[model samples]
Target: MSADYDLLIIGGGINGAGIARDAAGRGAKVLLVEKDDLASHTSSASTKLVHGGLRYLEHFEFRLVRESLIERERLLKIAPHIIWPLRFVLPHDKGLRPKWMLRLGLFLYDNLGGRKLLPPTRTVDLRQLPHAEILEDRLIKGFEYSDCWVEDARLVVLNAMDARERGAEIRTRTECTGLLRGDTHWTAMLHGEQGDARVTARIVINAAGPWVDGVLDNAIPGIKHQNLRLVKGSHLVFPKLYEGRHAYIFQNKDNRIVFAIPYEHDFTLVGTTDALFTGDPDKVEISSEEARYICDAINEYLSVDVTPEQAIWSYSGVRPLYEDNSGNNSTVTRDYVFELDDKDGAPPILSIFGGKITTYRKLAEHALEKIGGFEDRSWTADACLPGGDIDPARFDSFFAEKMAQYPWFDPEGVRRLLRAYGTRIDRIIGSAADAGDLGQHFGATLYEAELQYLVEEEFAASAEDVLWRRSKLGLHIDAEGQERVADWFSART
Candidate 1:
């Protein structure tokens, strides 16, 4: 295959895909290689909120906070279907920060960004509102604010899809095994469906998230960088415990917060335990202790107590943060930094260290600016990602029209189709007249047609890619259904 390109990105996570999409849109020929399916790593496994982390205000990360807030507005415009506004209720802790202080922080968060399209924060009386009824009696007041929630994995896929649409090549199940500096270009060895292939590129980007250091040590020997630090974070999905559409944010005694958000219409997502890690990112898993820790944290603040047995699913991922040597793990930086190496003009290699999903767009723009001295003007700022063509204001009407078009489709199914696939649901379901026409049912909301479309169009290769990354049906499907999917995928390959 042709190797003449301006950029080659390692890791198909958000940062790599984002950079690939941005670079390709700017007339830069780009090739992205992922060891597994897109977002099989940390990209898909996130708390899945696009916000200026409210807690970051404590650490005084003003720059990251402001940038993230601005990007929230930007990403909402670009991918309205996948990223939509949600109101978070933070129950006031009488002892934590005082009411006036919380109000001041909310004021800063609301006005930090351009503040368009989403409602501003407001104080709520816990004694009278429905949202307040669920809170513990000790919490007498709270603050409600706006933030965008996203289908994390789909965001990664849409970036790759958009990159492909812009003439970029994306290789899944392709591991970058070797990197060597050629006479004039950098040669990268890729092993995948076509077997091993040697490709050449003018620049190589190491956006390999948690595996950035390993890629450098093995693929490009002797490459030294003093940036990345992989910290493990874990989350748990439990049976729905409350009955409101609003999400809750509870402050822990240790000063960290846990979120309990409505998930899958019948479940809640609670998580995120941050602990320093020194093992292989690939081997990271949520330990029993970590799971219990999260469960206990939630039980300490919420009205309903949750136990480990109540958890339906749990996931863990390593955040590839830039080493800041902060005294506390929670105080470490969430902002990203890029390391651009161009020794003796022997094909530039840029290594990305820390980033969050909310700011991936801006991170990509900045990464490309350093990858090359000259390129087409930045075009991704206003460019809509693939399938993000629906007007934000018309989402309700458009969804209504789709329901009319496929009257047999369940309303929940229609909403999922629109949220996950955007305006492209028509392509997946096609002209199917009934549920039977959608193909074999694998339990819950999964069907053979959607699986096939994911594999055929979105680069899904394995069962985990379908069950965990592409969708969260694993939480609902039984062992038999999983076996059927595994058998089907194995037989197809």
Candidate 2:
């Protein structure tokens, strides 16, 4: 007999993980399977902002913006460690959108989505201390507004962890090779290192992201499933573009926008072109033209002149946007659209299209609503995820407490740990008497205790999962350090 479930989620992105947590919390047997690590694709490759999509205002996405803005504060309240306020300086260029237009939009943005928690927009002079030193001389004035930065990958992981804690089955590196529908449930063939297995579920959520259409193809073959417009967004990480924690939103000549945000304590994250993608999603990479376009956009707004070669690292991901037949890929709706096929009271499969990281929670709620039968028993909005029980207001105070408790360890390491693990830092270090007890230091703050905790608690199986997604120690840990981590995993495997 196949293991059965109430819902079988086909992807482990933010959407799938969020849905799993929501459904599992409501007393439903849930199984979420990912062909790769959670957030390995679009979820982790975002700009990492829980913003209201300020640019969406130009496209008149007011409802989407409002919903996102409301969720922003709510998300911050629940997971303050991974989500927090970030101020964006929007410089008014000469040829781009005028000041009056910008101010009017800002007014609407400020009022929409029941703005709270984050501060309102304020005008600043470019001739001021930080702005004068950072922005180009031509940029005399700009508007600073509130948005929030998220540890994108961590958000997905936390949701999955919470779902697992709530009795949901989260299977990573497991592919649904074939999905067979029965009269009342789905027989899903899963392929993983443990070998093939079959599972049954009353409902299936096709949140396969870039492969949403492909999942549909597996269930309903012969007919092409082409509701997606794959748009490749690429980002370049340069060695710290200006100082301070404040990020900049640069307006380009092509009526698009690019962001330069402080990243990983030692780099600036930028880029995200809207080039249409048709090839394999796994093969997505930044094109030279796109790289040059990003460099030009950076140069246009900031005084810093840079080349593509200056970037130390870059990453790219394909967004599986719902095809609205829009002329421009960038102008396509970031809003999610759902397709539910429950023809003649048969088993239903709901496929999700589009959607950004900011609204994943709400998206999950709505997905459940579309699935039907679940009560108005929603509870995630007020609950905390994993170790995010710390008061959002006391993130700093909590950090200080952790620092004081671990005075024997590097303060920087403690801060990073608290930020990454929140209250669960105790799981890794509670018993450790000193830094030496944390075990073999891989590099930087990475230790054997932390590695063991990641494997046992956070579902981290590989060194890449620990170094890249779990924490960005890949940037800090030297090559020798990285090899040691790989060997550590290798020895275990």
Candidate 3:
């Protein structure tokens, strides 16, 4: 059968976008379809850390930890603007895990992954620091370790952008309704705002994060497949809990950990409760109980007790973890698994399960290897994603240069732009003599020029795409500003 594309990828999360970029770079004719805005689910709802899951060491997931650690450094280098080093403070909880055990875990984490650019773990005397007032007095000591923080949604967008630049067709808000497999190709019926269309591809890569099994069941009915344990993880955003650049990893009585990280320059992002989820992934929200659980978990360690009413915002996502039959939801493995169905010479369908943001690129490489038609050598290891060409060692010099070039812009605004757009800032700010030239001011440094760039270059269809995913300005802007931005999009569309 003749195929319209060499590969058709379902889902627009990190994994799907990564695979599309890799496959397109490898010279495959690729088409990536998304049911909603990219990173609208689990990919965006993460704690937003690129770490070697320090707790995974307790699960004896040595390989996963090592691979994640290696990828962490690589990602920092490739996307230095959005991805940068973040130090995590783990306060000692005597009742939960002893000092010696914590020390042992930190020791292994520092050594397990090839420790390179990031600094190794070190003990801290929390009592000596001014921020000690914010912590319970019993937590006199803690350990500081390295990880990277990412603008999670931007990572997904960048991957999709790079894939599109490499000749892959990216279709957002496009749902793959049905799939019919032939001996040499698979025909997919796609329905979107534009209506329905059929796309034939030589292969199908289902990188649907939480919809992997759902896609398979709809496409190939009557096929026995591995069950996915859908675990809902939720987070809460509160006014800055502490005044520090470092984030905190708190230990709870249930042996689960919650992170309170600095967010949006004005708030603290804390969260993540693991409860077995049975509802639709798209409709998942932070339940009141989950919100109380998060507050209770962090309250045990922080001096300032938190209540649900104090929460400014919250989010939840269902992780499509491969069913490992673990007794606890928190114990589920974060490693990815690939299932390939290619019986009787029919076109292959490779379905991905259980992956994290840190290991997405490697997962894509392995996915292509499993599908088999691509060149054996991997190329993404050294290639930088768009706007990520800055030298990690000299990011300061680069920012200084940008400020010099855009003297008319506010220093803080330029810094924010550099972080979000990196070298691509020029494209957004192009030839603007001053702030007024940047067009209608929506709010908080967001301008019409930047919004246009997002709609045209990136796949941003509406205002929330710009306010939330493309940038976290939603946290800063008020209702009036948000409504104005929405009106602008509505009038234009």
Candidate 4:
């Protein structure tokens, strides 16, 4: 099968999906193909904070910091249900950066990008604030600041769903085997369950995260590049450690910061260690040493100790960083760069590298801007992603209403659905009128209605796609529950 489109995007991660949504909203004929489920890779495995990159302030990445800050607020408004405000308690550590320097950074972080909506950063006396009570006695002074937490994988699906709503063609589990230039167009081959198909497009975008270089090597052979680095980052999940709703930013002895945040209700998500990677992205795993390193980092600041056995789950993903030749993995620029090659007047191929979850939307807009004269103007800033319709200010009230409507649902369960589906809960729950109406419950919040919704609307092709990526129910659902769900999915599909 052959279809002509204005733009063809590779990789269905945040950047690719974001670009697809932006291009499609602008009325471009768009096709996006993902080798796996959307956000099955680094996107879903992120620490999931929509921050201005507070640490980047030390590096003086002012522009990136400001843009990310603005986007953080914008995303909160756009996806009120999935993305919401999170307060981080950064305990003071005299050994690392000094208090004055940290204070200056916070002051700048507070005023940067015409601060609005989110509360400004404030100095916290660890002795006075109840949130800091869990910290070790050595930490007395701290800073509390605002950032947004995201359902990272859901964000990708929302963008793709929104793009499809605007007429973009999204192919999941479709491998883009090759690309070839032909006069004024590029032909891309994709293999999937339906067998091989070809699509011709005016422009090809290589947003293939960790595999961008590989795509160029295989799809557009003879292209040379010396400007990308792959850095592997790993995170671990353990049983909930602290009772407070806020998160912690701990300063490790090695100069990297570790985050311990509330995750998936009963778990605390902590991570990540950054190191240069030398293997395939698909083969990357959380090594035993990485787990030990992460646990040691968390144990450094907390009164309680975390061990390897305590880590219930862990994952590793490689960041396709734009190589600046920085000596340290943590010091590399988080900003993105674009490479457009258009020799002999053929259709151009644009490749993207190095981006954070916070800056994906803007990255898409800018990537399209640099797509040269072939594409239309940008239009994603004002567009709302799927289920992002609620006004940011009203999310609390909306959540309250959901709790009131489903009085039978446990408070935790209601909040989980609201946080995951946002304004789309009505679609998931429908008019069931009670808890039983949600269909078979696999475990935790894995109701049949929601799982079916994901498969039907969000392109959930497998049980892993539903359990791990679309939702983090994999951590809550027992092995037996997972087997049952897998069996049910196989029988039905």
Candidate 2, residues 1-493: lDDT per residue as tens digits? 4438999999999999999999999998999999999889989888889989888999999999999989998899889888888899999998889999999999998989888788999998989989898888989989999999999999999999999999999999999999887788889999998999989998999999999999999987788999999999999999998999999999988899999999989999997789999999988889999999999998987877999999988889999999999999989999999999888887889999999888999999999999987767989999998788988789889988888888898988988888888999899897777989989999899999999998888888999999889888998999999999999999998
Q: Which digits, one per residue and each the tens of the lDDT, describe model 1 over residues 1-493?
A: 4457778899999999999898888788889999988998889889999999888998898899999999998898889889888899888887777788888889999998879889999888877667544666777888999998998998999999999988999998899999987756788888997899988998889999988877777646765655677778898988887887888888888888888888888998998988888887778888888899998987766767778888878889999899999877777899998877687777778888989999999999888777655474877767777678888778999899998999888888888888888888988899898999989899887888998899888998878888888788787789999999998899986
Q: For model 4, where is the 10-residue window of minimal lDDT?
A: 372-381
Instruction: Work out the TM-score per prediction.
Output: 0.96, 0.99, 0.98, 0.96
Clash statistics: count for each candidate: 0, 0, 0, 0
Assess the local accuracy of residue 300 in candidate 4 as a C-alpha lDDT between 0 and 100: 75
Please give, for residues 1-493, the per-residue lDDT of candidate 3 as tens digits: 4799999999999999999999999999999999999999899999999999999988999999999999999999899999999999998877789999999999989988888999999989989775488888888889999999999999999999999999999999999999998878999999999999998999999988888998999779997666699999999999988887999999888888999999988999998999999888979999989999999998888888999999999989999999989999999999998889898888999999999999999999999999998867788888898999998888899989998999999888898898988899999999999999999998888899899899988899898898888899999889899999999999986
Model 4 bad stretches (over 4 Å) = 1-3, 129-133, 224-226, 374-377
Per-residue lDDT over 1-493 for candidate 4, one digit per residue giving the tens place of the 0 to 100 score? 3339999999999999999998888888999999988998989889988999999998899999999999998888788888889899898888788999888998999888777989988888887656555777788899989898999999999999999999999999998998988888889989988899988999999999998988888756776765678988999999999887889998887788999999877889998889889988888889888999988888877778989888889988989999999999999999999989887887889999999999999998888888755356656666677777888888779878988888877778878888777778888988877779898889886788887898888988788998889888888889999997898789885
The lDDT of model 4 is 0.87
Q: Predictions ranked by lDDT, top down? A: 3, 2, 4, 1
> Residue 429 lDDT in model 3?
97
lDDT of 2 at 60: 93
Between candidates 3 and 4, the one scoring higher on TM-score is 3
Candidate 1 residue pairs in backbone clash = none
Candidate 2 overall lDDT versus native: 0.91
